[model samples]
Target: MSLARENRIDLVRGLSLLVIFVDHSNLSFSGALQHSRGFCDAAELFVMMAGMSAALAYHPASGAAGFRATASRTLRRSFKLYWIHLLMLAAVVAAVFLLPFIRDPALVREWSLDKLAAQPVRYAVEAIFLRYLPAELDILPLYMLLIAAVPLFFAAIDVAPRLALAASVALWLLAGIFHLNLVDFSQPKGLWYFNPFSWQLVFVCGLLAGLRVRQGQAPFAFSKPLFILAFVFCLVAIPADLVIHLGEYGETTPLRFLISKTSEGPLRLINALAIVYVVFNLDALQRLSPTGWLRPVFAAGRNSLPIFVLGEILSDIVTVSVFGREGIPLALELLAVFVGVAILLGFALHRDRAKRRRSGKPASSLLVASQPEPDYGPETTTEPPSIPDARPNTAT
Candidate 1:
């Protein structure tokens, strides 16, 4: 893909991360930004981006060196992701404890640390094992596990691209049918909020799509009728989300349990793919310019790992300290957005500067110097792209 096209992917990733932050906080604008009004949310987009990025970085390695390099890079990234998750977990737990002393005590008893305080050692052990994640923190653990499984996914893809996808789908279906899921140490019977078994299907689809992107073809070649159907389904979701009467119809209702992020229900996966199909088919990136007003978002996407973690921490703080109180001013919400973007931009600048100092070159050159560049020369068919074997090195 062209650099311009990749920038657009970063734009979507950044925007998704931003919206996820808003959704985490109880800000009013969250309703406008949150895709949960439909069947998917920022989590779907984030995971999809991660999978595609991984494939783009590692799938084309040619020999023993490439294979070992890819494996080492992936392992390093998994380690970083796990460490970051632990740090964030500690921060979140601290926030849960600290917020009450500074704000309304009644507001956080359920959402914060009451139960955690009851059994600190057990919960700590669970968090370490990634079996006791709370709401916002759940996604991190899933990403860590998924990163660890990158090698297996690549092995499957090597055998046959379709085989990888088929395996992913089978796992998802079996998980749903047998209720195969990870148990939370905090609650022995509690299932993982974002079940990796099911969500892997979405990631696998993205990985396959990335392979097609390298070959200069669309991932899923849906017919015209299928594309139209997908469009109509997305449109219907807008109203379906607004209508509350559907819930009153009970569990048997067609829409009641149609999709679930927790189990990554089939319908939900279909809905997310439908959106991706439309976006890819239409050259959606053409509409978005990296140098345009959306540059901040693009930067955030480029540095999604730190930005997402920071955004979550900030959003949660706002949720307990500001949103939990009555009548939150619009200015405050807008200020929150500004602050988040500023932090992301500032971090980007710092990273760029530090990279330049290490490389002794222009900051832009250093930005991705660590990554192997993709080789698309005359020997492309025989030699793998030489570009960095490491993905973005960030768990989006």
Candidate 2:
């Protein structure tokens, strides 16, 4: 089959990164653009896209370099993420500690790291083990763990097309039923905010969808009835889940499991899938113009890891800058959001240009970021695409 690569994933991933910065920046104007308007947020999108990107990057086709080599590379990428997480953790901690202007406790309260300053050594150790998560930073360790498990997921793929998916769902059910989670060091009986046990279900689903893409097919067959149902569900969710009755995970609430972000709540997962289906089936996303208004967005998503790291720092910088202001001006909020996005876009484009330069490839149009690469087999080249390979996460 001729490869029909889709650029929608990059487009959506880039959009999510933008949303993440705006949301985390805590700018008052972010409510309109951030994921708070939905049941699931950018974190969910990034994880699913990460799984899809993993399939593209490390599928057996790429394994012709030798499955051993591929496995080693994937694991190495995981370690690289681990080290980067640590560095980011240190930077975040130091910034919070050393910044004199950030005197307002409320400004830094979201970090939830009151104990960290007192015991840096101990917190560092816990962080190394994927514990002691601070706000906005927990996703890194989760990504690190998931990337490290790619080999196992690929193994299940080899065993049976649906085996991994089945196991993923079963584990998710078990986790929800038993409240399974990795240890959290911040408090007694604490657990990771986004539980990998439950979140794996979505990642595995994305992996399966990507497998279809690798074979030049759409991720899901279109069903008009299903589309209508998903559309209705998403609309209802905005009001029921995000607006009215969007309560916390209160024990007595009927929507307890639905609101629990840690367990990848059932309603939230369904909402995420519903939205994805509606968007993907509409077919508009398939024909996105990479060089159009979203050119910067595509660039940011193409080099997501670096753009993401930069965005987090920028978010904190903005939050700190406005700590004591009586009220955040709309102008500063707008500049923070727009300029932060521009910085990320520039960084992503720079990384893309650097890669093209090093490879001695001619400069590419904006299409370079969204070009669909052929999914090759053994007869095809084993070299991974420079387009954000799950490995060498650096766009280069």
Candidate 3:
């Protein structure tokens, strides 16, 4: 793929991450915003897009060189994520420890030191990206595991993409059947937000999409009828499930349950798929380019990881200091927070772009540089064109 296309993916991922940050921050109005129709359900979209982006970025090539290249890139990303996880862990710990010193004693009292201490071993295990950590911990362990598993998964796809997808679906079903909650596991899953077993399907679907793209096939571009059907299905399924299940419908439904944000159930997965199909087929959406004002949202999507971490830390501070048990007001305060974060993200992106431009390279090129080079063919005699050193790309 061209550099521009890859950057666009980064932009999408950044946007998804931003929405997720806003969604998970649990600031007062998020619930209502999440419930509203037009709001992007960022969590599911982020997972799905992660899969799609992975497919687009790292599908296997023709020979041993291709396989080696793919493996090296995956490994580098996995390690990078590991480092990021460490940083996030440090941030969370720092926030927890220091918030009390800066904030009122009454506010500090609501903070849960016991909860942090309760799971030392779990947090330690999470450092390896094996299990899910507590919600209070903002890091995503499962995403790291998925990153580590990418090469293996891609190898399987190279041999038999369909088989790989089938296996993923089977595993997903099994995960649901066994109620395979990573949170229940003794080891920490990669991050609190992602669970490998359930989330793998999203990745596999992305792999399938990537395989098609690598084959020079368009992964999207639905017929009008199909698009309409997908749209109707999404509209009906989401609301129907909500109405029928109502309060009883936790994220976990027996057949489809994975790790729902609500309960990590099957319903969420279905909802995610419904959303994906609708978005994938919507030609009109494709026509909608990032406007000048909205470009920052795309930039946020590109640097989703840092922005997400920043938002989480910011939310933690706000909740611990200003809001505490009472919580921020649901209306104006929530809007202000969201707008404030958006502005900050815009500024960060602007600074990052300026830095990259000054350094004489594209930001996407920088991400590629940080990643390990693929170990495919013999070392090249000719040097590849140098791209700019941009910030590391993070999933939203």
Candidate 4:
């Protein structure tokens, strides 16, 4: 079977990134609207959408030829993530160092060599993408590890997808119950924003969803009943959030905690499922129409990595400078920042597209070639299989 291009997935991803951009800028606008449970719900939806997109992108194909192709493709994508991680690390360090020179010395006092040295060697190791870093650090390190783990994850699922998923869920539950924060002594403050023990389940869920989608087993596709059920679930979640107050629940409550994506809880799983249902069932979203105005947003989605990095950097600057202080007109400032980032992302995407066009290669073909093949399959499903890490495909 051919790999179907899920336009709704792209739309969900596009919307998720936009919402996350605002959420990450909580210091700016969203803080003012902290009482808005809708905003919190939106953030949850964004995370869910991200996981769904991953599922759609990397679901495995059937047979040996398809599996090999998928593995090769996954390796290439992982390599690109590695490069992105390296660039982000360098950029973050440079930004931290330069802040003292560009702004007040006090602005970077937290990043002093003495402060950094006080942390364990594991911090440095985690900083290089082996483990979780401090909360103040960017969450990219977790993503790098997740991308690196993709091949192994896929291989394991190839042997027994259900068993692998069950184990992942069990690990997540165990980590919560026992407060099992497994640290690679090589990496410091190993439990950062994206705790591996908690977050791996999200990735595993995505992998399972992808496998289901590939198998045409997803129940949400083009179904009115599924759509209504998803809608009802979303409606129920709102009141449940109010009653449960998920934020108040600590790690002791694994099921409650996981649902709270902000706290890396299981609720995130339901949120992701709801997002998948909504997107998959929306008939209008399945078709891609090449309109001039929308070309940029789609482009931004296509080249999400660099754009996301730039957005983060820009958000950081805005937060530390104007919005970081109290009494700013947050809503207006947020609008301005969002518009500014959107324009910049649009321009960057357009330029990149132009460059590609000039090179006489179809952008879609390049995108496909750049992506690694899906490696999860019936023959290869197991837990933590021995598959080689995917390499980056720079040609795209």
Best candidate (score: TM-score): 2
Sorted on lDDT, best first, the list reads 2, 1, 3, 4
TM-scores for candidates 1 onward, in order: 0.81, 0.86, 0.75, 0.71
Off by over 4 Å in 3: 1-12, 37-40, 101-113, 118-132, 136-139, 181-193, 241-264, 330-332, 358-396
The residue pairs in collision within model 1 are 371-388, 372-387, 372-388, 373-387, 373-388, 374-387, 375-385, 375-386
Q: Which stretches of candidate 1 lie over 4 Å from their true place?
A: 1-5, 28-37, 63-65, 98-100, 103-112, 185-189, 220-223, 244-256, 323-327, 338-396
Scored by lDDT, model 1 comes in at 0.62
Instruction: Kindly give the stretch of ten consecutive residues in candidate 3 with the minimal lDDT sum.
Output: 383-392
At residue 359, what lDDT does model 3 achieve?
60
The lDDT leader among the candidates is: 2
TM-score of 1: 0.81
CA error at residue 56 for candidate 1, angstroms: 1.0
lDDT of 3 at 260: 45
